[model samples]
Target: MEELWGRRVLLTKQFSAVLDAYQTFPAMIDQGAYMRCTRCNTELLKTAILLPSGFYYCPSCIQMGRIDSSLQLIHQAEPANQTREVFLDWQGTLTPAQEEISIALCHSLAQKKPHLIHAVTGAGKTEILFEAIYRALKKGGRVALASPRVDVCLELYPRLQEVFPKETIALLYGGNEQKYTYTSLVICTTHQLLHFYHAFDFLIVDEVDSFPFQGDKKLAYAVSQATKEDSCLTYLTATPPQALLKEIQASFIISQLPARFHRRPLPEPEFIWWNHWAAHSKKGTHLGKLYQLIDQLSQKNHVLLFCPSIHLMDCLFQHVQKHFPDLQVEKVHADDDQRKEKVTKMRQHHYQLFLCTTILERGVTFENVSVIILGANHPVFTKATLVQISGRVDRKGAYNFGRVCFLYDEQTVAMKLALKEIKLNNQLARKRGLVDEL
Candidate 1:
């Protein structure tokens, strides 16, 4: 029973039968006059189905394991107190700027205040959270590190496990096989947070500005519900939305890391105009320039070609493969079943180039890689996305510089804004003496 703290399960007939007769209680799960799901707070009455036996069924969150009127949700109460030894085995040290921000973050967490870390890509944001997380765990508080992207969650799991080897750390995602356990720290996707209620004392949301978490209201509600009343919330992102910026200015404590952890400036994107690229692509003509760019990068360093849509990605993939028969090329998107394998292969240097959509724009890093935006003027490419895409280049210390090319028919506001933001961050880094003397 002590191990069931912070665990929830839908009380279906199948689950009811498994419970011991003495442990079964009437008030354990209740169905009120109005049908509503206790887990997701979804009004089941709106999407209810009346059965012949005169009961209602909810289909709203059925995909997450069904919860109907006849079924009740059993949420285990959090433990009152526990004694555990917590230690961090990591030996890496932070930069002076990062150390200052990390100390400030620890102070904010101690005060239980909301804070934001507006850092550039490759700023070692994950390392900055080590001290704060150590403090939280040492105090016997549960910590949750959530990200909007599964790729980010997957990337963070092993790193955190290595750092806190003695503590119980669980990684939760869509297709994970690991069973739910009462762990001191949990790393999960934002969608998985809907299953928890007042569970975490220290909640850190990485990539807070990324998709699904940025615009969706339900995920916002899930974040709010997952944290305790006095829990400290921290948001980590390279590009924060205007609303978050306003909140940072007015209420939240904010810290900024404009330079990469390696003390290198962000790679500024180069805009190259190619007239009638869409028409040429459709007619299968005027691909000489594109080929030349790819050829240049293929000889040295991996390349990531970003397309606006799946259709465009497929078209470009076909074009690139047709033109360069000997080069190793692959295509990946959100629906690709082999996305994980493909990404792993890319990291293993099995593929020379990859044509992909915005799915690869964030949370993945490739060393010695050059980036190319095929249609920089497309409306789908936002300023924040463009910055993230450009950030894919020159992330590792071994290769501290790479080209970021924006191949466009015409420059849009998003392109200019992304470039301007990169330049401004670089300038700030220089002013603070954070950048190398390049």
Candidate 2:
């Protein structure tokens, strides 16, 4: 029953006997030729998603588990809310601006209102969430901090554990092998929300604008379904997508933080025209500007070189190795089994040049690193993505500002917008006297 608490799960053979003793509801509702998954709100055509046993299943949320016609969902009652002696254990101080936002968040939590924290990169978003989370937990409310990126969940789990040592904090993701237990605090990927039904009383979604989750209806449905009707549902992001921005303007409470916690301006990108860069990299010839930029940046700081496409990253990786035979270099992409290991090594300063695609664009941080984006004009590099990639530089405030170069054959709207947004943040910071004069 502890395992089933706060969760709605399909009645498989393992749960058949246990659930039979309890109560259950249909996992999906039938509507003639179409059946809708109650968990993810995805409608599936019966003919299109027929199981081998002639059962109709939901293909949209199959990643969580098949919610078919034959199965019922069982939900055990959540244990009574339990208070803790100490809900928060942080010793850090927030800037006045951050304190204001944190107070706003706490108000939102108390009111159970939808809210958005529109902060610049490195604006201490996680810390801003701590006080609100503390208020919720102190009152014995169930809370979940979810992110679209698995890396974010992985990074945040340990921090939450450190801050809430007395509370049971569950870390849920696709790759995590830990058994689920009913917990007061849960740090999970957004996709993991599908298993729960009206569980969390305080739901905070970080990186709400990031990939896989962005524009994903199934994942959005997961967030809504996993939350209690009267819960505080807050979104945290450096760059809010347009659709989300509209929603914020229309109804949601908003808090904007324009400066990094370190009181430094975001590093603006330098757009350099490097004609025929990819073709030259593929031919292993005529890479004067590219070689020169790498040599210059790598001398003092680690360089994260971003290629718009994985194939382009591979081609560039080979030439980089040949051109700089003496320097240590590494590359990682979404399919790379060693992605996590490589990123760990990069953070330890093991590589001079780390090449990657958009997978490394956000949710991870490295100190004393500069960023280089190849093909910044490529269709794959959206304005939000470019902003996030540039944000990877100087996150720790090791320097007053970090170098970010976009080596593109042609400048793009995304490039311009990213630069404009960064500049706007810096202006706002300066206007507020949040950053030191250069």
Candidate 3:
């Protein structure tokens, strides 16, 4: 009981003995029982399999560690009240737009209202949350910062740790080995929130437009279950969906930052028509234009070549290496074992050419990098993804301008929409004097 204080634990049939030893409650319905999940309110159905021991298991959240019948979830009832002297160590200053939104966000969190910060990429959205998070921690309130991608969590953990060094900050993921502790700050993937129960006083969902969390009802339910009833929730995203926008228009507190932290407009994507380029590339014919583009760009800038699929990325990587033997090139995807190491190497300027899929589209930044979206017409490349990929360029203050080229066999609605959105944001930024002179 002492060890379980201020922690939520998911038990299974295998832990029946432990349930008997401690105060326990059913985490899910028994097999064949007409009961809904107390947390997500998901009804038991055929998917809930009956085990050999006459118990039912929820298959809905099996990916988040299984929750079976006869298993009891044990949660410490009392608030942890584990407060500490939390201080912001970050020395950077937020832009005026960011400062205004940051103050409103802190007030909204105090009032337990839902808010959304619609900021473009490289807008210093993370820094804006420091004030709100600091206030939450200082008041003995637990806070959780969640994102759909583990890469986002990996990037945010160290930064948040540096900002609130005295607070216990826990980073949770699928295979994390860290034991659950009474921590004031928790940074984790959105999927990991399924394991939490009414735990946080404040919840911030970053990259709300990204995958696994964007349209996932289960993940959304998990987020609701994880936070307290009165806990404030803040969403941050560059491209918000229609539903979220409607919510913002109806009631949610809304804030917008169209310009980046460097006060530069987003790099508009240039459309390059290459008819049947994929077939020609596979045939090793009509390679002059691509080679010329690479040759010209590789002279001074790092190139991120976005392929539609992993197989295509590999094929393109081989062809590029064969053609440009002197150039440093590498391919990465979701399954790459050395993805972190490769990204580090890329940041260290070890590789001039990075060929990848949408996996490198968001939550990653490189200075003086130009983007090439091969097969931009592919159905997989959505408008939001293209915007994010284009936003990757011109991120650093030292080099706040770069090229974004979309190589497509045919013009796609998504591609056109992406370009138009970027232009509109830049126009708005300039009109508001949020951007520097073009």
lDDT of each: 0.83, 0.87, 0.82
**Tens-digit lDDT track of model 1 for 190-243:** 988877777888999999999979976667877888888888999999999988
Q: Please provide TM-scores, in order, for all candidate models, with all chains considered together.
A: 0.91, 0.96, 0.93
Selected candidate, larger TM-score, 1 vs 2: 2
Candidate 3, after superposition: displacement of residue 128 in Å? 0.6
Task: Give the runs in model 2 whose Cα sits over 4 Å from its true position.
Answer: 17-23
> Can you tell me which runs of candidate 3 are displaced by over 4 Å?
1-7, 12-23, 30-41, 78-83
TM-score of 1: 0.91
Top candidate when judged by lDDT against the true structure: 2
Off by over 4 Å in 1: 13-37, 42-62
Model 1's number of clashes is 0
The 10-residue segment of model 1 with minimum total lDDT is: 21-30
